[model samples]
Target chain A: MNIAILGFGTIGSGVYEIVNQIQAEELKDCKVTKILDLPQNKDKLDIIVCDINDITEDESIDLVVETMGGIHPAYEFIQNCLQHKKHVVTANKAVVAAHMSDFLKSAKENGVQFRFEASTGGGIPWLASIQKAKRIDEISSFYGIFNGTTNYILDSMNTLNEEFETALKKAQQLGYAEANPSADIDGYDVQNKVTISAALAFDSKIDMKDFPCFSMANITYEDIQYLKSHHQMIKYIGQAIKKENMYEAFVMPMVFASNSLEANIPSNFNIVTLNGNTIGELKFYGQGAGKLPTANAIVEDILDIKNQISYGKVSLDKKLSYCNTLLKEKYLIRTNCPIENEWIDSVECKGANYYITTKAISTKDFMKLVNSISDQKAMIAKYM
Target chain B: MNIAILGFGTIGSGVYEIVNQIQAEELKDCKVTKILDLPQNKDKLDIIVCDINDITEDESIDLVVETMGGIHPAYEFIQNCLQHKKHVVTANKAVVAAHMSDFLKSAKENGVQFRFEASTGGGIPWLASIQKAKRIDEISSFYGIFNGTTNYILDSMNTLNEEFETALKKAQQLGYAEANPSADIDGYDVQNKVTISAALAFDSKIDMKDFPCFSMANITYEDIQYLKSHHQMIKYIGQAIKKENMYEAFVMPMVFASNSLEANIPSNFNIVTLNGNTIGELKFYGQGAGKLPTANAIVEDILDIKNQISYGKVSLDKKLSYCNTLLKEKYLIRTNCPIENEWIDSVECKGANYYITTKAISTKDFMKLVNSISDQKAMIAKYM
Candidate 1:
């Protein structure tokens, strides 16, 4: 089987190396025949193609792996490949999150498989596990540290008592975060992952924009110290819970007990969890994002296709509505203007900051209250 | 597809419940047609069969789920079913650990699948995950808390300051341990699981008895307290590492940092890890053994067969020998007898007990020295 990789970048080059180096019977006949990238980025002379049609038009190429890491041309190219009856495997979460339903529909109509195991949790076999689990169990909820960059920053702040910006800069130096790191630190990366996970786990179509995401960019050193003093530490998490026919999905910085699993997740590692009816709660922990790890997941999907191992079909037929008001939890609010509220359980004043602990309140209500305030520097975290 | 259950126990009943309750497209036509058990244990009159031939001879029964926990008849019955070209799914660790290679051989000859996902980490999708990982990466080593009963005992001893016997009794009351409790406390259960895991991970046949297993039964409350004071906690773990042409595998009580993931694994929960070439380290945490959880795994295998999803073939053709002297670590020894050796780093006498810490020494050397002593009450643990 001939394979083509879109974008000869970090993950794409790693995929090419693994496809050529792995000694597996199923992957023995598999070869990277074409690479879609700019002329200057070409490492191999024989297989470089700047146009998508050059590879899509070739009937010999049976599979396409997308590592382009964008939504625009990657999504259109994936749709074209599926329409051509070619199997598609991707590590792009943004495209999968935005066009999952459309891609599934196209793949179904074309009788091909569209897999994105690397789209969430990096090297962790999370999507395949969830698909297997859904065969015999009902997945009611899932939540975890989906972004490695924010996790690194938060973990560093807690352990080394470093400021948020200092930790983020360190993460940037280590290549864990990009120079323009708003997608990761501001919770957009986690939002995309949460959308993909919820779609697969709950069998429902979810819009990434519909889910409210609270940024971890505003978390300060004082907040981490205060939470640590209270036997808790902060972790940026993307969580989705199913309540009857409604679903509540969001991304926020949450406080966990110092000794809990979430707090103990050090460095840039991630821990994702799923609550099943029969299997109970199962957690998958590993490197959330990296070149080789992410490439390993993409190769796994390729092998699955080669061995005729189908994860069945991607069907989001479950009619579940989104409602953040269905879930309620206590919140830790740090702001300059918080004087009176019935939900306020306790309040502490430190210099110019009013740190208030609110009683159990709906996420929708809390976000509404926070948005009503003109203080853009206010930071809110959930109590886990 | 008609299915036959070879036991009417905890896991067998769970498989039946999930197979009937799961609303999946692939399992729509799958039904439990026969159940082999004694007449006194019959819960359903229409499907119960006392003889093995009642299941093997039935041409309509295409699959057999062996939940009968033993080596004798369970092993023989599984072989018979495979000889009859029936796919077999089992949760019996003892049978799988002892006759895994033989069962794989028989299943291959008859063109059938022999799966034991629940034999290692119950409901955690451990074996399946390992198989998927092996398709693309070289697994070098794996280790974790494979036994929940022993973990519960050790955790309770550390957290509640309960004696070993008291914790064992608590485990029994919660149905986590059997009446004998010998298999769990003596590390035989973990040994069996490690054997099965190593066979699948390294593609080599291993004997459960060949690997050394240290009993956690001798651990005392004072040992837990001493370790706690040093910022460590005891956890019973089964580990296997590949070193070129040889492999080192063992079951022993090891100390981990207090804030580590292993130390915080409370209650009867289990955590297993695998180290892959590309995926780095991935940890799976969940209930290792339970009625519904184990059964859920069995049903997952059954569904795989129904959907024509294969884990391919199992071939333990890797010519790897077992050796224990290649790995080295420090040891904490507490005994009534005086110990003197070049490896000893420090020693302190507390009444009639001698608490000694040894420098890095191979497990083979430490065990040989411990066995040379006539004192049967001596306790030793490895420092991680």
Candidate 2:
């Protein structure tokens, strides 16, 4: 298992450190072969500084790990590796979650393995647990505080009485949040997580747009204070609900009692749950994001594939189903403006913020209503 | 996958509910063959209800789920099931942690899986995660708040400043603790958790007597107030550390900052961590114990055996080494008694309490020193 790391950043260095510390001495078939990076890079002993074309002819490169995240060249690098029949391991949840169908098919076609347990919950092995549990029952729901950055910011604001900017800076300093924290704070990070999770749990072909996302950025400090006054804690939650014949995915700030598991998850930690017919509620909580922790997930998957226990997942494209019954679900809308519309069922307002629970409506209709009110800056979240 | 529920208690009833829900599904070769309870039990379901003796002859029963708990019949019953070549799934961490060698040998001899993912961190598939991650790297350490009853009590004490008795009663009322919570509050419950985790993480052949266990039973509200004075929260933690040819297991009351993952774990939820060479550190948090969640684990194991996936772990008897080089760990000790011991490298007594930091010592030496102080109880909580 000679491996190649594609990036040299935090996670890449983390992967290198982890790989160098392999204690499976008896199972020494696994080893890092090439430290792949930009051409003319100097850091280590006899490392290959080659592009994807050069990698194709290198049969010595048995395992390729891509820590170079993004949807472009990372995707291209992985696709080329799969074509060249190199087993691949990655921490790029975005690439796998969005294009698992294509990758899985391509991997199978090329008789190679693709693994990305680090994609979802870093270091927790939540993916491995879910994958192994799949033999027992289909997962009915999957939910979590998937983004550690947002969780840290929110917890700081509530506990330390720090402003959002101050907390954001702290999270960045702590390396929990990126310089541009939109992906995390705006819920798209969680959206990617829930999308990937839904695809894995339900084995369905779910696009990112299939699920709605609502971030804490849309939420005000007033909402947090009010929720706290009511003995509730706010958590940016990524939810995937499976109904009779269909499923729903979204991310929103949930107001739960102080005793709720979601409420107590503080700082840059994560708590996730899965409900199955047989397993009831299964949860995984941990360091949601970090360099070594994230790298650990990729390493675990690499070892797992080494043992031939299992390879990532059977692509979502193979399990795609257009569940028509999910269209008739109800929506939960929270708004800052006064509800002059008939869609509002009940409103609980404190100061300028309000939680307006709405009546049953199709997802399509709810999206239409939200789009119509988008220009007004309505707090029209989504049908969570 | 024909399974049986041995005890018709809360967990057993939950298992039945899940099985009933999935009775008409396309799950491969799975169904409940029998519901085993006491000798005289009657239900409307069309499943076999027989004595323990009748269980061995029933060839249809492929998996035996032992939610009966305790050491007796549950252990003997599981042993019998393994002898009869039926896979055994249990939520009993106590039995396995104490007698893991015997159980693993028995399962191996009979060529049957003895799955216990529902053991320590209930509802969280920690055992399965450990099993899968085993292929990756050698785990250096593993530990967490594995007992929900004590966690619930400690969490209540942290939030509401409730008395221990009131919190214990509340935990019992909320179905988090047993009527007699001596095992939980007294640290024996968490002791078993650490034992199992150590066995899984380091393949350490150490039981309750191998390390030291200090309880939360004596974690007075006064102590809580002192911790609060330092802006800390108290939690009952079961943790393990591995050193060269040695390991330590203990359950004690710990003080942590407000926003820490371990500090923020609310109510009865449990969170554990795996510190391995390749994976670095992975943390799992979840509902540590519950009727439905435990049942889900049992059912999930059954499905694994049915699907021919390797869910059971290798025996820890042969590969029993807990050796790690990082032995000089840091701890925060709080005691009402004065710190006059030679092991106390540093001490600071403010009010009726003192915090002491100790030098590197073997776990046995550490406990002997802490226990040397006779008059008042003390807790030496691990930080790393």
RMSD of each: 1.7, 5.3
- Residue-level lDDT tens digits of model 1 in B1-384: 899999888898888888877776767898988999898867565789899998899999999999999898998999999999999999999999999988999998999888899898998889888888888777899999999999999989987989999999999999999999999999989999999999999899997777889998888998888778888888999999997889989899888898788888989899999999999999999999999888888888888877778665677998988887888889888898888888889997877888789889997788777786667877788887
Q: Counting only residues 3 or more apart in sequence or on different chains, how many pairs clash (N, Cα, C under 3 Å) in candidate 2?
A: 9
Candidate 2 positional error at A180, Å? 5.0
Q: By summed lDDT, which 10 consecutive residues of candidate 2 chain B come out lowest?
A: B317-326
Number of the predicted model whose DockQ against the real structure is largest: 1
**Clash pairs for candidate 1:** none
Query: What's the TM-score of every candidate structure?
Result: 0.97, 0.80
Looking only at chain B, model 2 earns a TM-score of 0.90
- Which one wins on TM-score? 1
Query: Candidate 2 overall Cα lDDT vs. reference?
Result: 0.73
Q: How much of the true contact map at the interface does candidate 1 reproduce, as a fraction?
A: 0.80
DockQ of 1: 0.74
Please provide, for model 1 over A62-119, each residue's C-alpha lDDT reduced to its tens digit, 9 standing for 90 to 100. 9999999989899999999999989999999999999999999998899888999999
Each model's chain A TM-score: 0.97, 0.89
Q: Give the per-residue lDDT digits (tens) of candidate 2, residues B20-118.
A: 565533343566668787645655455647587666778887888888888887888889989999888888877887777788888889998887877
